[model samples]
Target: MTKKTLAFVVYPGISLLEFVGSRTLLGIILAQEGSPLKLGVDYELVVVGERIEEIPTDTPLSILPQKTFADVARPDALVVIGGGADTLLALEDTNLISYVRGAGECASWVAATSTGSLLLAAAGLLEGRLATTHWAYADRLQAYNVRYQATETSNTVTDGKFTTTAGASGAVDMALHLGAQLTNQATAQFGQLMIEYDPHPPFGRLDWTSFDQQRAILTPLMNRRPDRQDTVQDIAFLLYPGLTVFDLVGPLQVFSALHRIAPEFRLIVVAEQAGPVMTDIGVRMVPNCTFADLPHPDVFFVPGGTTPTLQAMSNPAIRQYIRSAAQHAQWIISVCTGALLLAAVGLLEGREVTTHWSFPRYLKDLGARYVQKRWTVNGNIVSAAGVSAGVDMALYLVSRLRNEETAHTVQWLIQYDPQPPFGGIDYQHLKLLPRCMRGIFTFVAPLYTTKARRLTRQERGRPPYDV
Candidate 1:
């Protein structure tokens, strides 16, 4: 069997969510066990950029492309990731446009998400084709002789071989549809379950009645370019293999918006090394700095996952770095089971914290009392409930760090207003799953707890890790 390559084109300032959301879904189909498909066997996923360098995203963290455009001129499929103003800027990049046009011409099918459709239109590929982009940028498609499909009617639009998606979140829907086309329905459904793509937006969908007014509010905010300040506070996010992409990206998107308007706030992703780290969903993310490079950031953030997170708890280097950084950090934050890592490090002992709903017992085993809430703040330590909750908690952090008005602007900028299709999670009916998970954690908890205890003893008499 020949392996088909799926190339995702990435550039500086591209929307991280739009890029990762789709890649994660599709990547999982290849990586997930028992799926019949295997990464590098049945399919290969690669992030393609102009050069194999660190390209910054709309968020603080940057992505490292696995291949250059020159390397993969003809892939099985091509996906162009979109962004805000920078996406508009990308339209003027002739080299990029040429690369996109040339590669897209030879690909089996070409796709774009959000404002990325404009890039396709710019390359003269979408002319006379029906397509969709971010609702905010949909009107611009008419200028290229492309018929626009309303996002209200459909999140993804397919006109012949060209596929386009509505917003950043729309990428997920697009990926699922494409995944099914590439494989089978069952394989795509399995991929969806692997990532837990079940979304429950707290608010319920956007109220389109006020679309014009909402658009008016966001246009100027997107255009504003504040001057960088001399003294900037560093907000560091931890990156590791197998960490949930949304857990890191959700809050990172919130803080990234805050950084745009409030230049004094800087966002950075730190890891054991400065290179590409594979996420749990099979997408690779690049960190800007090493742990030793930025040891004492103002704010230190940890994102959580499943088995890898438990494995991370026992890693001496990761544990020591968190322990050392927390000593001088003004704020320490965690999303999902990230709280478990902090608990393992002895930071959450007797502290009121919250984690993903499935791991309260694990949190308790590590010596922290779990409070069931979207987020909990005890002094400078803040822990959010689960994946999507990070966005809510980060907004609260923005309000605290800057001001209510600033946070409100950031919310509007990201269009954070949630309208889940099926409404919010009903914790009342979610008993059996957590009960089953507890039995599994029962066996897994002691292995890490004992190791954590041993690491703490070894570090007590010594100074912090050199990094």
Candidate 2:
């Protein structure tokens, strides 16, 4: 079969989730089996920028552009992504606007999400077209001479060849809609299942019961079904009460994209019970499997939280599970304070590791070198600092599991390039804060650690430290 190309137009400060969500959905369709088409064979993915250089996102990481507008003049589909104020400034680039116009004219599918519609409108592609953008930018859409969608739901409006969605969150909806339009509803459903795109957002209100019913029907169609080839590597994500959602999701999302490229990853969310595990942010993530049900995993990932994580560190069952899982696992990974769990289980002794910046001294107390890096690797153990750094660690693991090129492709698929809005606050800036503000944290930090130690001892049926 002849190959078709899909080009994602990116610029500095583009929303990573918007580009990642869309690319993942479409890539899953290409990864499906029933379809005679295959990614890199029947379909190609190209990340096009003004030039072949690194483009930063709203996060700290940056993506390497695969193609330049000078190279990919036209592709089967061209999606213009969007971001913060930088996206608006990117629209002023005459060459970028010209490229969008040229690509829209020739590409089979022309689409944009969030502020990307602004670029589409600037390119004159959304003229007289029904469209949408970020909810905050809905009023701004009218300034560009396009009909704005006022709804705040996850919906995509497609008028002829021009497709648009509300914001970064709606990109998946737009991608699935496009997938169904390109292939069929069944194929789109297959793609949706591949990425587990069922909407159960933390901050947003969603009918989880209805979503659960839908997943019951869709889970069988997902490539990660239990009955699939036993050789597939099982990557288990540990879920405990009150764990931080982003710490778990950051790496899990990276692995999800890798699954699209190679269906060898079996992602299982395992908890003590197969039910909703409340996160620190009040989001309840339902585990896919129970500790009793999950076999030994190839990769064991642990995410950390506050009181709950501290409490879990002393849970004999959880500690035993981690110890046993780490025994057979080729890679043992942790994010944020999740390293504390490893330390408590006697796994991090004499190893270089990192954790959330606020508590690095604890690692030294636990007999590990506190490396102040995004992520640290020592033999089979991988540790990432803070919340979002898990993305870097996971991508690095993907490189180890497959190859650097495959990891780069996965990174491009997710638009892994990052550029923080306010940027990082250095030690000097932090010291410039009010003395009372510094005193508050300093006074509270040890108290939290002391309370956690007390809770850990109580959970372990041991005497309190001071008592």
Candidate 3:
């Protein structure tokens, strides 16, 4: 039987997710979900150039070959990986440009990830086309006159034969989506389950409608972080001063005690103003209660999203006001990078704090003296790992505030059983990720360290801002 060919455009600085994700999914489908028997699907990564030439894979050691436009086998489809450096943006390779336009003119389908859409736009295939990429690259794509939807994730745009996804590993989603289309739902669902694609965000479905009220406070914050600009990394590292999860189905399921009681605690969303809070998932959240309208609660949580009101943090008057008010609040907890604000206000300092494990080393270097723990408690200040960690932290907080019985019951009511399909090693492809991302971590370390010390020094009345 003649097999359909899948050619992935592998360029420099392309996201590992796009290449690895798409390729892995195809391989999984063709290989038939770990079974001894095999299915049949032929997928290939063909980098475009003058002729067949070697292109750098996501990892430094791996090199994917480029197929010349003249001899390149007309693929059943094309998937262009993005997050490439600026050079790829200009697209000087006429062979690539020619091949894209020619193939797109002849082939039935074309797709792109993140900035890879720029290539489509460059090829003149996406003009007047509806597409999407990473939120950070929306404006860049818009400049090319491509219609943009900022909310799409992994791989999820299906505009006729031209599919586009926000690449960062979204290529994986695109891969699965393609596999599902080519094969069956069972394959796709099995793949999602196999890799534990399920998410347990502490916040609800994040979006503008959900966080409707907080738009007033959030718009400005979002404006300040148009690129996201490694804000989480910047915040975490500066606060940690590097830092750094898991599938635990052990005898003591972490929150097993919480599965036995009813929860009395209520959720309160605050903004120093009345309204919704935008979550990091590119959506806004409206908590059960608003802070301006509700009475001071026994526990306060700042969910990890974007940074809270810079006005709240930046203004000398507002900062002073919050410092005074927080003194009376029973518990002040920041999940994920939200601790950056807490520390900035002199709350988390002098107290051991914990956040998601991504920045453990940085946090300690920044003055947060602690090790790799899921939850960290320094008196009334509690911190947890990344977004999902909040579920456990929330239960733990319930247990401590109310009782173990209450926390346990709430856990049971919610059925908080986590079965990460990837298990103990979910995100273990360390070397496969692009250097740009790793460099973001490397660059952020010293920068945050400098910032943390400066903040400390300012508090100490030293040189005004140097620790």
Best by lDDT: 1
lDDT of each: 0.79, 0.69, 0.48
Instruction: Write down the RMSD of all candidates, one decimal each.
Output: 3.9, 20.0, 17.2
**Worst ten in a row by lDDT for model 3:** 233-242
Q: For candidate 3, lDDT tens digit of each residue in 242-316?
A: 111111111012222222221122222333343333322111222233333433445455433222322233444
Residue-level lDDT of model 1, residues 264-307, one tens digit each, is 98888899987789887555778888898998989988989888
TM for candidate 1 is: 0.83
Question: Number of backbone collisions per candidate, in order?
Answer: 4, 9, 40
TM-score of each: 0.83, 0.51, 0.42
Clashing pairs in 2: 57-419, 58-419, 59-418, 59-419, 61-417, 61-418, 62-417, 62-418, 63-417
Arrange candidates, best TM-score first: 1, 2, 3
Under the 3 Å rule for N, CA and C atoms, how many clashes does model 3 have?
A: 40
Assess candidate 2 and give its TM-score to the true structure.
Answer: 0.51
- As for model 2, its CA RMSD to the true structure in angstroms is 20.0
List ranges where model 3 is wrong by over 4 Å.
33-62, 66-73, 84-90, 152-155, 199-467
